[model samples]
Every structure is written in structure tokens, then in C-alpha cells.
Target: MGHTTSTSVSARGRSTVPLLLVALVWSTSAVMASAQAPTSLAPAGWDAGIKLSEARDRNPDPSIVEIDLTARLADVEVAPGKIVKAWTYDGGLPGPLIRAHVGDRVIVHFTNHLPQPTTIHWHGVRVPIEMDGVPDISQPEVKGGDIFTYDFIVRDAGLYWYHPHVMSAAQVGSGLYGALLVEDPADAVGVIDEITLVLSDIGFDSKGVLESADSGGPAGMVFGREGNYILVNGKVMPTLRARSGAPQRWRIVNAAKSRYFLLDLEGQPFYVIGADGGLQERPETTETLLITPGERADVIVTPRGSSGGTLTLRAQLYNRGYGSVEYRNVEDVLTIAFSDQPTLPVQTLPAVHRDIAAPKVAGATRVDVVLTLPPAGADGKSEFRVNGVPFWKAKPYMATVGETQLWTVKNESKFAHPFHLHGFFFLPLDEKLEPIHPMAWKDTLNVPIDGTIRFLVVFDERPGMWMFHCHILDHADGGLMGHVHLGPR
Candidate 1:
């Protein structure tokens, strides 16, 4: 086992703090065994007695793995002396970590116990039409005190997440998300240390209470709700110890409502090997990677030997055309300190998959998803719009199955919006509508604040209803969401 430590980190991104004081109510320890049993904080009604760390992630059963999650209210201490009332699964700030391997069956028995309705939408998974978890689109909302089952084969291996579909503005915005790591059975992670970080930000009022989803009034309405604190795996700027010469794989997920993390390493250079869909073809070594809301990045690095051996994962503060109002300095998300004593062996990686096929363009249809913002209303406030329509009243776009299409996503908003599409990954295109990477697949693409992004997508196999929207949960909740019907019809 290795040593673990934490400290009270300020939101101002100050790196120095008293070491004795740990973050929030959690203590310091290595990635240890599961708790002896469930705590009282577990949802009391159903069989919600499960530990946060014992959520079937390490199960090597090599078959169908089934689990239960009870969605209910719980209190999580985000920082020292700071508690936020949150909607959780099995009573935790970030819900259970769902783990599976490719070709395995994942059966999640979801039970909703909150006062209102909710549904667990697999954020990046291409599941069946009836199991996609979009209320009134793919499936109905799971009402309070109701139970629903999500059984799907782990087809693609990658980093993904799950959160609520109904009331996402409040449910996910407040805190109801978790990581879903689907490993590739043939190409496994190597001996090096691996960490899965669910990066998030939380907002609070002057009264030290958790801010409501609607707290951000007008400007926040147009732009997404921005939080103050940067959290990694539920802790504020926690410190992680890594061996001097070991490589590490950080599977990171940006689970915030609006915060865009322009991550950069202070000590070592990062090799971006995978994305929301899966591994990239060849590793792209870069100093910065932009991870927007609802996006995930699988980066590998060998920390130590640079910057005096003080490895830090910092975000280059990005306002995304929000002006100086939301401007803040760079945030230190996590610290990776070199250790004299070794822990785990360095992990090895297999051949990457970079040759994603391009959509056939000769006979492909051209679809326009032009994001448009309407004029300010009488109240001098503006609501988000997609194709000049909102989700509550928008008409569904129809596409044929087995058809290749060139999608033009023009972001006409004042602020940047990360667009995400369900059911399929698309290949990015250049200004000429030609393939950019020619081999990279992405389910989420960053549409610049007043710029446009093009993609070539092929609707293969599944004939289902899928939602495409701004991944910023608040923006999506504000009606920046739309749907598409894919069928032989």
C-alpha cells in the first residue's frame, strides 16, 4: 500500500496549505478495500446498503454483472465544514462508479426515490432505442418510487458517465453523476498506476448554502451556470503520490454543468490516447487539452523529473467569450507528487485504434443543426434555442438508417457551447467539409462561441430516437436540446 494525504485547498487555486488538514470529511488513505459494510447514509428505504468503493468495479466475473442503485437525497460535505444537500445514488455526492469490460453485459437496476421523477441516461453509450433513457423520446421518465432496468452489452470500451434525464438542470446540476469505465478485454491497461477522476465544480451562495439550479439569473441563463470550486473525485484539489519513474493513466471526465477545463500539466507532458468514444489512433502529445462539460479524456503521463518534480494538473482559466464577469485565475485541479518509495508498476498500453472510417459523402445528405439565439424577451432575458426552437416545442428531425450525412453544427450563440450527440460518434470535418482526422471518432464536439464545426456521421445499425444538445446541463435544461428519429421509414 502507498501513503495518501489531503489538505484544505482554497478555491483561489493557491497550492500551499496546511498539510494536516484534509479536504472535507474524508480522511487520507491509499486505494484500499471496500468499507466493512454500508453506512447509515445509504438510502434507507430500499436495499441501498452498499459501500461507495464496492460498486462492482473490480469484479472479474467475466459475465453479466448486475447492480442496484437507489436515487435519493443525501448530504455530502464537499469541503471542510461545507455541506451540500445533493441528490445521490446509494447516498454519495457522485454516484457509484459503474465498471465493465467490452463484450460484457451490464444490468443496472435503477430505483428512483426522490420526491420528483428522474431517469439515468447513459451519457455516451450507444444503447438501444428503448433503453436510451430520454424521457418521452427513448423511454419514459422513471417516476419517484419507481424502478427501471437498463441492460445493455458493453459494446465500445471507453470512459463515460451517467446522470439524470428529467430535471437535469437541478438533478445533475446539483450533483447526480458518476463515472462508467468500460475496459477493452483484448487490450488491457498495463502495470502502471491508473486513476479515474470525475472532475466537477460546485456553486454556493453567500450564505454558504448550495446554490439552486436557477440561482444564476439572466447572464447565467444564456451562458451555463458556472461553479466556484474545482473538485476531483469529490475532493478539492487533492494530492496524489506517484512513483518517480512510473507512468500513469488518468481517465478524466468533466462532469460539470458549464465549466470548460483547459487542462495542462505543470510537470510532465500528457499523451492524449483516448476520448469519449475510445482510444485515439496515435497518441497526440500536447501541453493542453480542452475538456468541456460531459466530455472525457484518457491521458497518460510520466510524472517527475520536470518542474522540480511538483506535478500539477491545472486548468488554464477559460471564459469562452463570457467576458471578465466569470474570469478567474488558473485552477490547480490535482497535485501529483513524486515518491521515493515505489507503489505500483508502470502500466503498458496496446495498439491504439485511430483509423475511424469517414462517412460516405458522394450520396450523403447534408443536415444543418444551426444553433440560433433569439432576441431578448420583454424581461430583457434570452432563452437558448436550437435551430430557432426549444426542446419543449421543437420538432424532431428525421434521418434514415444506413445513411451517411454531413452535419453542420453552427454555434450562433454569444458563448461557447459543447455539443453532444447520442447513439453515434461522428468524424470531424474541415472547413471544406473534408475529413479532418480521417480516423478519429467523437460523440461530443466543441462548437466555438460564434464559430461552426462540421462532422460526417453515419447512422449505422441502430434505428432509434436520440437527443443532440449542448452538453452543459444547464444550457440543455434551458431548452437547448433537440431530437432525431432514425429508422428505415
Candidate 2:
């Protein structure tokens, strides 16, 4: 229970509405100007029926969440009659959900029971370097039977996650990952029926055996291996019971190794309110939400139709690169089964927004990073490069603490790459080097094939080595990774 004040939400030219208003409006219909529904929007078991198993908090302190996490091998059933020996955290696929409040201290006592050495990378979190979980850069790898402790403060209210930083492509694809949600008590998104969806995939043989990480070799590495099975919270086409026309807040995380989840709700619009770092300046609506690897989206969707009818959440084909969508078909991610109640009238949503200022870039230092894929060598192995060299042969980029830098990343390769920066959030820049509208902090952005992305970031007082790489685990493992040395001012 750290008493840190959060600036993620701001009341600018509008009233600061709290979540309690939702209950009040639904119960009495006093404060809202929209059509009222039954006090119980969802059935008794509907809200908690389709959710990931949560990690039990051991700490009694209201502000500190402590949990023990073990990485081991477990037999998880992704689909009926199909079970695979998957590498997992806490012996479960997609691991247990870790929930904490904004600015709360989280302590994870981790033990590695798996065969290989591994470390847990807190994705999209603003942790100190020592807790970053990148082997050899921030901390050493935790070998088999070894124990480690991760202690950090949740500075931002958003959906983050954790996974193995060592052998990420193999480990994460084998089911070694979980979700970390940091919530703000003052968040104005008044919807209470919220669910956190972890989107991922895994491949297995016909007899339910896990696929090899090196199954495709060089060609597989070039295109990034995708699982044959799509998963939402470790289940195949799991069904959720929802009330018709009742808004449900969805915090979605794309945890796939390389797959991009371009989600569509039968052409129905999704009200996107937040992203990787937290709530944006304002909400936007889109018929489809593209959540790339390692990305998260906070959105609201109202499932509507005849009672007892179901609506499917489908993952449409997205062209990440060549062959990504050549013969692929749409994937059914989740099935929302509506309750037997009649559809309620459409209600007007509250205008919930955040106040985030664009980073000043007038005197920011500029850095250029070119992503390229060279031809296979005599060994017939493909490798991705940054600035014309692989991470192994490249020098560390230098930056001083308290300095702001504008990075222009140009992808000259034939494939798309989800560029990710560790330990900091950046503001995506437009052509004028100015922050994009509906300003929101981001830790990862998708760089399309032969495309470019620019962003402005400042290295704060924390000085240590930080990593930057492609979120596509295969590409990163193939050498499209680098580090930055943030020297003390």
C-alpha cells in the first residue's frame, strides 16, 4: 500500500466519475442519462465463470501482494482429449493471473523446476534494471532447482505480463507465461463486468505430444513458427455467458510467440479505451483490434442478440509478412453465450479519458536503427540484424540518464517485427516527430515489412543496461536484439 499518487487519470474539462457510479446508475438510474437495465446485468456465475485462475496472495498487507511462482512441466489440456506436457508457471498453461493495485509492491518468490535455465521478464513493466529478468544483462539466469526473487512496484495501471526471457521462443511457445494486471482504483471506466483475456497458441502432434521448438529450423525461424492451436486463457473456443447489451470491459493480452491477433466481433465495433501502458487520452472505436505480439488492449464490447444465441469472437487473418496469411483461415478465439434475458436498450457510455502530455522532442537526440535480414550462411541458418549486425556482434547503444532520445526504426526486412523496449514506455511519434493523437504510453509497436516507426523516450534516473528487441521470439532469438547502456548523469 504505497501512498504514491497516480497521474494516469486526469479530469480536464469534465467530471471525474468513479466506478461506483456504474452500480448506482444500474441500481437506481439516477446519475446516468441512458436507458437502464436490470440491477444484475450478468447472471450469478457469468462474471466469474470464464476467467483465468488467479494466484493466491500470501501477504496480509493491503498494499503488498506476495506470491510464490514455480516454473515446471505440467500436463495441460488445451482441448478435449488433447493434453500436452507443457512448460508452465505454477503448473498451468498461461499461468495464474497476478493482480495488484497501482503503485503496490509485488514480490514473487520464483523457483525454477524446469530442466533449462530461465528468467522471468516482466513485459511492459517499469521495473528497476535488477528485476528486469534479462539474463546476463540485469540478472543471471536461474538454473534448474535455483531460486530467485522479483520485487517491484507497479507504477502504471495497465495489463502487463511475465514470461521466460531465456529461450523465449521455445519457452513461451511451450506455455511458460502469465498475465499481470495493475489496476487503478480511480479509473473512470465504470464497467464492472471485466475480464482479462490471454491470447496465445501452442502446437502439438496428433497424439497430443508437444512440438519441438526447432521443428522448422532455418525456414521456420525466418517465418516464425506458429502453433496449430489457438488459445484464449488456455482453452480452445471457451464460452462466456454474458447479458445482452451489457457492456463488458476486456483487458486483452496477445501472448502468442509470433501470431498477431486481429480480432473482429462480427463487424461490431469495439470501444478501445486503453493500451499497453494504460488509458489513453480518449476512447476510440474500431471494428477490429490489432493486438500484436506482446501487446495489450483495454476495450469495451457489448454483446447483443437474441437470448440464448451466441456471438463468436474471431481472429481474422492479418498480414504480418509473406506467407503469414497465404493459406490461413480465421480462428475462433472465444464464444460469448448470451443469457436468456431480453436485450437491453443501448446505453451511452461515459466519456472516460486520460491526460497524458506528449514528450518534448525539440532538442532530443536522434538514433537510427535499421532492421535487415541477410541471406543464410553456409550453415543455412537465418538471422535478423539490427543496424547491419546481430546482437552478438553489435556494440551497446549509449544514453545518459535524464536524456530524451528520438528513435527512428526502419524495417528493411521482408517480415513485420514487433519492436519492444524494456523498462520504459515511449510515445509513438508522427511524421513531424510529434506524439500521435490520443496520446498513450507504449512499450511495443509493430513495425510492418519495409516500414518505419518513430518514438520518443527518456531514460529516467535509473541507470543500468536495458534490452530492446523484436517481440517475435523467433526473430529475437535469431539476433534482432540489442541493449542500451544508460550511464548515470
Candidate 3:
């Protein structure tokens, strides 16, 4: 963060790593100088394209890492030749990556300079009640030119993110999200080349203008906002260099309003090691991994092939609940090039993370939740409902602290929705009401159309009201969001 902003830009003809990517670098020297801010080793006023090594150094001591961020309106290039107006954090496409250790203390100094009120919700982190950032529930909205400090202990280690809670659909859609990595102490060096890919679907208007909208129609209301362009770290077709036969860790996040990413690498199988909460006991191999909105997947891949062999990262396109399908050479987010350098050894992992027991709903209370869509209006606008009613500003249910509850969610809607619950992770149940991943933890999951999902969660986190909503930002903004109060019985 020392006024040195660098980016790895790989053009069509340029195969070598370029030193200076002037276009990707946004100058914050003036802002720092104007504010007379003090310098620190933490990632304050940093860029999104920070190198892996520099990023790791910024959080050498997680116990005292101070991540400074600000929200403001700016115009930046989202695509190669596309310039769009956006509300951004530190004037970057996606905000700077905040890295720390599991036991570290994360202090976020958030400043809002936008036209409206806003707050940063530390997505998926089990922070304190006050640090949750939900307006009127945890804390009031930080008004324009105002500042708020969110300090909390980093509980779990994994891929997570941060974005505004108020007007989340508009704010997050305008490019205000970024990734968070809390490292596990057991991970050894020479393990793998770790990288982060913040996947987003940037929506542009008919006249090529960026706006916070879900198309204002029945389909959008039902399906949430889906973008035409798929971007990885704010670029299209970015070349990601990987050593041949070397194990590399790819931490991927889907920070879109609605689009679900069905990820697959050509000729390479994904060895998923972790999910939204953290690393699994061992790697789970799969050809196709469905990463819904607000979910994360930590994958280890080794491209074993000749030099210059291109491994493209493609997302299979589907008309959610419809009939149409598209595949093969779709939007390419990352092009994995097997470099000529010698490959390193595969990474080593611990026996297992601390014992995370299965969700025991044997005698736990059962709660039934249903998802449905109200009939379309005259203008073809539909209202997405959770239980025959759009979400009002109130807690629908009061959860008992430290108590286990079995919740069954049925999707009677026309399309699939990524179900996300804040504050705690749950073990999803199978058709027979059994623990699916009794050990592995996840905060966000997808609920298929005309289907059902049941999970048992032990609400052991701090007593407070937490959000449970569709990860599709538009759906949440369109009154498909609610709060669950977790307090002492």
C-alpha cells in the first residue's frame, strides 16, 4: 500500500508480464495527502490488483491489521474499452483484498463519501453484534462524509467478502465488493501458488451505460439481475500464469447480483479444498462446481501438460429453469497458461481443522420456510416473496442462542435462488433429513426451483439479529430479505 500500485495486465499479443499497467492503477496519493492520513503496513488506500506477496505482507500480524476503506462515486473502466459510472471502494473495480490470520483482529475504518447513507457488512464473518453493519438492527447507516469503525476478532479462516448492507443491490452492483482471506496457520510454504478471482457480472444498459437496475420486469424480479459480461478482477479474458504440473490454489468468489457461475476448466478437474467458511478435511474432486452468488470455493489445480497449453476457465450458461442452454467457448474469465518454469511440489494440509461436529437436530426445534413468487402485475413486474409476503423491516423469527434448530426451506418459485444466512453456518439435510456435510461448513447455498433444502444450524454466535436472504442482490433489495434474532432464551 506504500503508494506503489501495480497490476498484472496480459494483453492478446503481450505474453510477458508488463511492469506498469497505468490504466489499471488509480492514484490515491492526492486523497491521502488531502486527508493527511497516517501511514500503516495494513492495506489502507490500496488497489485491487495487489500482488500476492505484497498482499500477504500487509497482514503479517493479523492481530493488529487495520484495513482502511472508503465508499465514493467514480468512473472507471470495467471492460477493455468500456467506461462506466460506479460507486466504488478506493476507486477500484473491486475493493482491495483484506488478508489476515484466523486469530487476528481486523479493524476496518469505513468512510462514506457517497451521496446516500451506507455501511459495510463483513459478509460471512462471525463478527460481534455491533460490527455486523446492518442498518437500524446492528448500527445506523453511516451518512455521507461520515465514518464508522468496525473492529472484530477474525474467527474463521476462508474466502469471504465485504459490501454495503443499505441499498446493497444498488451499492454492490455498482462495484463495491472485495475478497477477504484469513489464512490457516497449518498451511505450509511451497504448498501452492495462491490467487484470488472475484467473479462478477457487470450490467451495462442498452446505450452502454452502467446503472443499478434489474431490468424492471417480471423475469428480472423472478431471476434477479443478470449481467451480460462476466469479469474476473475487473478484466475480460485475463491471462493467469501457472507453472506446468504445479499445484496452485485458486480462491474464487461470486460477488454478482444474481448470476450463478458453473465453473469448469478445460482438461483439468477442480480439486476443491474448501467452501464459503473454510478448508475441508481433504480435497473433494469435481468436474463442475456450481458457485452461487455470495459463495466461495477454494480449489487446488495442477495443469499437467506441455508449455503454452491453454486451460480456459469457462462458465456454462443456462436459462435458469428455462429450456435454453449454452456452452463451449462461453465467457472466458481466466486463461490458465502452463508456463515453462519448473513446477513445485503439491501443497500439504493438516489432518483436519478443529473438530466441527455434525448438526444434531435430533431434538432440535423444526422451522419451515417456503419461497414463492406473487402473481405478475399489469406491467409484468413480479414480487419475490419468502412466505406469501415481501420482507418487511423486522425479524421474522427469534433464534435461541447456543441452541440447534432444524430448518426446512422449500422452493416453490419458478427459478433457483442461492440461499444465504448470515452469522452462522449450517449443515444441509438430504431428502431423508440427514446431515449432508456434517463436517464441512458453509454459509451460503443454492436452493433449486420446485425443490427443497433442509439444514440444521447451531446458533452459537453472539446474540444479535442476522440477515437471511437470497444471495441475488436484486432479490434481497426487492423485499426478499429478512432478519433472524439470535438471543438468549
Candidate 4:
């Protein structure tokens, strides 16, 4: 997580709005361009040996169970004999992968080894409010020298993750994050080797020391604090070993604080089997996939036999504001070394389920939400507001229990917002109508630029105040967040 320092809004006056809107449009266009860029090698040498896992079974074979998440500073070897200071979990940048099946109970005895207090928020997991791990909101921050047990039952299964919710901008960028795979037992397991790719960006000097967050102001508020180095599973460049002619399942998550990743596997064809919520209506095959922060993509790639061959995963250059920022591609994210070894029987991917009972919204209540930017100040300082209010602990947004409500999210801001709702998943109902994807059930959804996103959501579970905000870390930190309170049971 990174942030631009906040400044007094009165300083800029009204002149900042046009520039802000232009910046937002520029950022949106940049993402589109980057998504289409070709794959290339990265500047840094790629690192290998990161592990992958399967989420079919709730009980993880002890071989892969129990990941110790401790914060410690270590030297990361980016180039030959060049090591940089990196704050990591379990000794790696993008910590170890934790996999489990839905309904399985998981107990992670987490120890806060960092210099300051921190708490891990399970990004998309549905657990008790007490176990949510939000500092001062759900639970207390885990202090250094203290240990806390994160015990919860996985309810919905798909691609999810965990990161420090306290001082997230600093802690997350310091490399305190990892992947969490929750398996849906009822769904058919897909054929192909399963892999988890935690995508992140790091801004560090030649010595590997990360850059500090920007001082908040107009530039920081609209442009976002971005990094220079792109990483996949903590490696500047990584390669994968696969048998020739093997189908692989890739679970990709955009863990970047502010940058959205447009991933392209040069010439290799793949299908997007799932999204942030879960699987899509059907697998949409394409050469590239775009994922924003707090979003996930479950894709399947079949590597044709090419012995000792390489597959380059490149981040296309995206144009953001007045001009485009180039992602110097050099090192391949991962190379697939094919062997002549006989491949195992391929598993068929699961079919999209459409019969899951969803509550009807026509008979439920409705709520209107407005996502906007605050009035600019004379100092060119800009602020974000949601529903005419900033983030406040006591004044949470609320809705009735057992009610299927229509949430009309109007984006008055120029930039696109990926709004996330905690606890309950929702289905997008078009501009005014609901078209729930066959496999769609997600806690996060992206809103279009200068557009409105309407979703019909049913709040039937236990009532509590859950978080709702843009996935963009800077925007979220700058008071673009609020909580939705479900009526008491």
C-alpha cells in the first residue's frame, strides 16, 4: 500500500477539478494500452522455486499446512550479488500460499514481528466480524512481540488474500502479503496444474530499499503513488517447470497498492475461468487479462510440448495521465521448462453453476450511493467522499436485514472505482437491470469511468458493519471508505 500525502483542499480552489478529471481519464486509458502490450523480459533477474497448491480438499495435507506470517527485514537478491532490504512474511516478499476448502476451519497463529502494530485482513473471506482483523474496527492490531490466532471457517471459495490492514500503505508495500486459496467442495475440480501468482510492484533504489509514500496533495490524490519494479510472487523474474503438453491452472491476484496489471502471455492462449467473486458465467479465453487491486483471476493455460522452452509473462505499458508510464519489460515473469516426462491425466475444469438460489431484489428495499470528489480547496488539495460523508467509525452506512436491495453507485469522480463490499457478495444488474453471472458471487466489483454501477444485493447473513470502498489504496486511505451496517438479527 502506498499513499500521496494529503494537503489542505482550500489551497487549490476550483481549478483542480478539470485537471483531476483529465488525470483520471488518462489513467484509465493507460490501463487499456498496458493490457495490450506484448510480453518482454524484466530488468531484474527472475527468481524461481516459489510453490503452488490445490484447493480441492479442505484439509490441506500437512505437507503444505500452517504458514508462519512474521514481519522481518531481510536482503532480497534482485541481481547478481545485489541484495536490498525487504520487509517480508515468512522470509519472502509475497509470503507463502495458504490453501483450504470452504467450510474448513483454519487456525493461523500469527506473530507480529514487525517494529509496529499490524493486523492481517483476509481480503475476501467471510468470517465472524471479530475475526476480520481490521485494526480498531474488527479487532485490535497485533502488536510486535504479541501473537494472535486467526481462526475462521472458509465460507465462499475462490481466489482471496491477506495483508496488513493497519498502516496498509506502508506494511503492504514493505512486502507483508500472500495468497489464500479457498476451495469449493461442491464444484468440479478443473484439470491442469494449479498455480498461484501474487502480482505486486515495488519501488526500491538500486540497493533495494523501497521508496516512501508521497506527501498528499492534488497530484497524490489523482495520480496515485506507483512503484517502479514489478514482481510475481516476490521474484523480479521467475520461471515455472512444467511437463510438455500439460494444462495449468493459474490463480492470479493483483496485490499492487495502486497499479492495475494488464497481463499478457505472449502468443499463449488461456481462458479466464474465474473473477474476484468466483467463476464467470463461462471461461472467457483471451490473450490478456486486466486485474485491479483486490481483484483476482482464475485462468487455465495449457502449455504445448516445447522442451526446455520459455513462456514470458509481460506487463503491457498502460497510459495513465497526461502521458503514459512505461513498464520496462526485460525479465520474463516465469519460464516453463518442459520435460519429456509422461504427463498425468488431465482434469476437466468445473462447469459454471447457475442454480444457486439468489434472493429476489424486486421485492426488497433499495439504497442509493454516490461516489464523488470533495470540493477542491485554494491549495489545489482534493478530497474524496462517499455518499456525502467521509469515513467515520460511529456513523456507518446501514441497510435492513433479510432485504434484497438495489445499490445504485454513481461515480461523480473522473476515475474508475473498484468498489468492494465486505461479508456479502453481489451481482451487477447492468445500468439498471441485474445480470448475475452464472458463477458470479463476489465481494468486489469495478465501476466504469464516470458511470454508474447498479447491483442487486441480498443481505441475509448476520448483521454487522462491513467495509465498503474503492480498492485503490490511496483513494481508500483518503476517506473514500465507509461501512455498511446490516440490521441486527
Compare the candidates by lDDT and give the number of the best one: 2
Q: Per-prediction TM-score, please?
A: 0.83, 0.93, 0.83, 0.79
Worst 10 residues of 4 by lDDT: 1-10
Instruction: Tell me the spans in candidate 3 whose CA falls farther than 4 Å from its real position.
Output: 1-62, 187-190, 205-208, 212-214, 322-329, 341-354, 378-380, 393-395
Worst 10 residues of 1 by lDDT: 1-10
Point out the higher-scoring one by TM-score: 1 or 3: 1
Per-residue CA lDDT of model 1 for 390-482, tens digit only, reads 888998888887778888988887778889998787878889877775245678888987889988777867787788988887778777898
lDDT ranking of the models: 2, 1, 3, 4
Scored by TM-score, the top model is 2
- Model 4 C-alpha RMSD vs. true structure (Å) is 13.2
C-alpha local distance difference test of each model: 0.71, 0.86, 0.70, 0.65
lDDT of each residue in 359-386, candidate 4, tens digit only: 5667766778887776777887766788
Prediction 3 global C-alpha lDDT: 0.70
Residue-by-residue lDDT tens digits, candidate 2, 1-489: 343433223221112234354334432111223333325467568855458999999999877899999999989988788898899999888999999986678999999999999999999988889999999887999999999999988877789999999999999999999999987654535677789999999999887778899888888888888898999999888888888998888999999998999999999889988889888777889999999999999998988877999899999998888779998899898898898988879967757666676667888899999999999999998789999999989899999988889999999999999999998888899887777887778899999998999999888777899999999999999999999999999
Q: Is candidate 2 or candidate 4 better by lDDT?
A: 2
Q: State the displacement of the C-alpha of residue 282, model 1, in Å, after optimal TM-score superposition.
A: 1.0
RMSD in angstroms between candidate 2 and the native structure over all alpha carbons: 4.1
| lDDT against true structure, model 2 | 0.86
